[model samples]
Target: MAECAFDFEVLALDGTPLPLSQWRGKVLLVVNVASKCGFTPQYAGLEALWRAYGPRGLVVLGFPCDQFGHQEPGDADEIRTFCTLHYDVTFPLAAKVEVNGKGAHPLWIWLKRQKGGVLGIDAIKWNFTKFLIGRDGQVLQRHAPTDRPESLARDIEAALA
Candidate 1:
């Protein structure tokens, strides 16, 4: 059983809107990130995964969010430069968005509906929240902030297979 019915709009770092449907037929790892958060280092692991499996249809789409402690206070340009210089991130990054609370982005609303976290809570507690989507555009898993990107490699491999 998987959550496959949701569709969302993709926005560039500059807020240029795009269609998620264009990424169909590929495996996706969607993550909510914050530049100043302790888990920011996860960006390195995510980039590694993207470089390793990208040719095999895996893409790690990063969505920077400032909803957590204002950790991501930079504008789009700053955020883009930081990701490139500090993490060498090559995967697509969406514009800064609110991933939790009443003003949360619509894409996140659908994500929470598909899989609630510990104790059935629908809120995203912090940065580094990850959702894995299979080639069929189905939600395969919802990983908590504590789940390491390296640990998700097996699942990504399975999805590719």
Candidate 2:
């Protein structure tokens, strides 16, 4: 396994290479998101967390994934538009990625290994699964799809401190 979260590189929604190394010292909330999922409204709380704690070094990265039920079937542009128009999300969003199975993104593979979900399962169960990374680039926690972003405030604040 990689030493830290910074050991991987992913692509931005615009197709630009985004190395997690750039966010080395920042607390990161990495989430696998989908526009059409039942948990889609969590975007608002995520954006709220970003806006509220961004200046203090919190970076919420949304990774659009279509692996679950084809909930996020849109292209990068459509995903971006939906997030902006519906949730007014301003945080950085990566291009579509596979969070499970053979085609999973490398970063996600690392994350799952770092902090497995319920019953120690490495596979991501659904859309909106969240991974919180500490400022030191270590995986801190794994949140299930049902866990709301707002519910994570205390943990986020602790990580920032």
Whole-model lDDT per candidate: 0.88, 0.95
RMSD of 1: 2.2
Tens-digit lDDT track for model 1 on 8-104? 7868887888567778889989999989999999999999999999999998999999988999999999999999999998899998888878888
Enumerate clash totals for all models, in the order shown.
0, 0
The C-alpha stretches of model 2 lying farther than 4 A from their native spots are none
How much is the lDDT of residue 33 in candidate 1?
91
TM-score for candidate 2: 0.98
Alpha carbon lDDT at 55, candidate 1: 97
lDDT of 2: 0.95
Q: List the residue pairs that clash in candidate 1.
A: none
Best by TM-score: 2
Q: List the residue pairs that clash in candidate 2.
A: none
How large is the C-alpha RMSD of every model relative to the true structure? Answer: 2.2, 0.8
